[model samples]
Target: MPKGEKVKAILFDANGMDREIAPLADVAHIPDKQIYWLIVSGQGAGKLPHPADGIDRAALRRGGVVVSDDRFCFSVPVAPNEGGHSEDAMILVVGRNWLVTCSDAPLSLTERYLEHDTGETLKGSLTAPALAVSLLLAHFDEFHTHLSAIEEKLDALDEQVFRSRQRHDPLNTLAVLRRRAARLRGLVAQHRSTIAALDRPDFGPAVCEEDRHHLTHLAGAYHRLVDTIDRTRDAVLSSYDLYATRVAQNTNRLLQRLTVITVGIGLIGALAGIFGMNFELALFKGEAPAFLMVVAGMAAIATVTLFMATRRS
Candidate 1:
């Protein structure tokens, strides 16, 4: 392989053979059975690749029956009021010289695996695609670790959701958490692609049946974790709705009291106006006993308002 090109398996002997390529080609030919694995990780998994190839990338994303992109592979976590990237996923798997790398992060995830200056093993033996699957799986493993961590945090959140309210603005917190859960679902869903790779045309010798099974098992584990997150999210949403209802009820009750008070005051002012007019007949009005009458009317109105306020409570 050329120096600048990325290769999970390389065969650079005077014999001119890389294990997997040799089986399929004359130059860079390699033994039929040597296994190799490689892995790399970073952020922006959307750009990451297995064997750094498009087809393999598709395979690694095999099981889409459940999860989605935002949840499983890429995540951005931050408060609504804060600014930051939320997407973070790490997982890659490799065995027997196969490569499985997961990381869309802009940096080279395979750098560490390639750190060893010289090893015949580093020369490469597995098919490009198979190596890609294996390495991609390794990346998924890292992703699983990250998800596990998230799960722990969510578990704690679940407890708190019940122990104390989500704060003065529960809806916003619920929205943020709901967004996080959605991202998780997308990330976990990609394992479906990983599972599908088991039957792809390029199953390199490095990717053993056992390894494939392990990948499937990992996918299942992620499914369970996602389910839990979803359930928790539902609870949070319900709690948010409940809180909103209570607030609305309290507001309505307040408005009702204020409405009755205003009407009572209005009626008192009208009655005082009528009594003071006296029809110009001086019906105890000439001395402006009107002031006393007004005071009495206001007091009566106040009493009525007070009675209503008290009775409701």
Candidate 2:
């Protein structure tokens, strides 16, 4: 252990009974062959016995940095906050009679679960698999709430996109939404794979039928969540496309206006050049009518150019 750090071990059974085993040494002397939750946080991992039969100390201590061996079926823990932002990674190692959770810091899930004192609330205590399932369900709740918020943002963005008067750029909003959707999808994929591995028969201890049923339901919920994310991504892309088309149309109109202005300015410049010449042209021969005629001709040419441009636009 890191200096004075101590690992917390909680022994529980299906009758909603819990007993705290003092210190790490008591783990080997438990009277019954029941499940215990060994929480090793901070440097507590240093105290764990290495390659102790069912427990792989090296894999557990890694804290989800590099993936553990596939044969061990360890899950890369993802802790999500109330806002659905993932906090940090941890590792879960489930065995036949013991469950080990390792992390660099204390986990919010453990704190919340402990604070609620959920032991006696249940008519019967939860099995190890059941406990794992509950933890996953908690994480998914946060994920679901986060997705709902994203969905709401998407709705607002959709309104802004469809309403032609809203001049603000939706591209930035779309880009942000796309990034969020992608990140959520990746997390969900990891979660899905972990759950799927747990559901398999050979991966871990044999879970009760009830636990299997719960896992099945959780898997279905995960699938639905992923589908929602996919749809959100598509919506963001569509909004981007609409925004691009609107920008293109605006650009075309702007170019048309600029072209008309350029033609008018070019005609004025040509007339000015002609009158500015040292050679005495008839149009500039000190006749007021001639000057007036030239001005009228320039005005007519400019008006015609503008008219044609406007008609085409």
Candidate 3:
């Protein structure tokens, strides 16, 4: 619609045939029953025509939704990476016969959704609300794929922390995973609320019974997604606990060895101190034989102390 903006539009006619069209072409020529889907990428969202009055551009950028009598508009976080980092918000505005999607970056999931065979089959059954639901479902699928990757990482971390002998500190790695999971959970929660709003009786353009059923199912799926994220976070926390416990145990073992060495050194120092006393006894007055006996006694005491220290229960 504007310079530096990338837009793609697909028009679905009453006969169910779909074709690409100029993104900013005059849609007034199309019949009211036909549907057009517009996908706009980059800094163009602010320049695109407003789908309805009272839609806040700031809210759309920050991730929010507004519903009206004939249309609804919402912005949702899109995670294009397997790391579950949401780079931008995807804004969608849907009316009776048209849907407009805008994002700051290209959405790979959207591309895949369009290229898949499912997209062809769904063309015949498509309505504005149904298409919106399908797009949202694709986003959820991306989230699931990201979550699956996270779960695998958690498993690997668990193995490294508990099974391996190498000293590994998973605190940093665990912290990162926890943060990602938390962010993912927040985005999914936002989507869950958006779906709930769509499922409400007063939601506009008035969702049909079939679309309403899909929304219900999507809501249930979002609930499960939230639960899965929570469980993954708990696992991270538990791994942290295990890691802390292992570190403490290793520290105690080190301290125990140091204590033994200190005790042995202390015993040898005491023997030397006793021998250095200025008493004129036969032990102190004797020459090399007495010195040899002192050395022998000190060595015996040090050996016994070390032996006792190292003995296991």
Most accurate candidate by TM-score:
3
Candidate 3 lDDT tens digits, 70-154: 7778877787465666668888888766788887777886788777733334353467877787787777878888788878988
Number of backbone-clashing residue pairs for each candidate, in the order shown: 71, 0, 0
lDDT of 3 at 271: 82
Model 1 weakest 10-residue run by lDDT: 73-82
Best by lDDT: 3
Point out the higher-scoring one by TM-score: 2 or 3.
Answer: 3
Model 3 poorest ten-residue lDDT run: 117-126
lDDT for model 3, please. Answer: 0.73
The segments of candidate 3 whose C-alpha lies over 4 angstroms from its true place after superposition are 11-36, 45-64, 68-70, 80-87, 95-98, 117-120, 163-169, 273-290, 307-313
> Which residue pairs in model 2 clash with each other?
none
- Local error of candidate 3 at residue 230 (angstroms): 2.4
- lDDT agreement with native, every candidate: 0.47, 0.64, 0.73
For candidate 2, write residues 216-292 as lDDT tens digits.
Answer: 77677677778877887787777778777877887999898888889888988898787778887665677898888
